[model samples]
Target: MDGTRDPLARDERAELHWLRAENTLLRVQLDILTDIATGYAHDVDTILRLRADR
Candidate 1:
């Protein structure tokens, strides 16, 4: 687009790209955190069940 030379337009595009990258990174981190939380919950439940059996 001819507007690429426009400073304001370029700045807006750069900011949008940065925001998208940050959003993607956050989503990945959230997925990892959720997996870790789920694993911990499962482990805790198992531990409780074992203790109850005793």
Candidate 2:
């Protein structure tokens, strides 16, 4: 039997929307972590340099 004319059913559309939102949230979180790690590395380097010079 032929299925409904719509290529994407309602439930499929909702799931896709939810997945896209989740992906966006994760992307933002990863960006924040990257920035924090970068800052921490810079601070560690500065501390090491100061100790070595003294």
Best by lDDT: 2
Q: How big is the RMSD of model 2?
A: 3.8
All-Cα superposition RMSD per candidate: 4.5, 3.8
Task: Give each model's whole-structure lDDT.
Answer: 0.94, 0.96
Candidate 2 residue 29 Cα shift, in angstroms, is 0.4
What tens-digit string does per-residue lDDT give for candidate 1 at 1-54?
A: 765664568889899999999999999999999999999999999999999999
Runs in model 1 lying further than 4 Å from the true structure: 1-8
Which clashing pairs does model 1 show?
A: none
lDDT, candidate 2, 1-54, per-residue tens: 577586788999999999999999999999999999999999999999999999
Q: lDDT for model 1, please.
A: 0.94
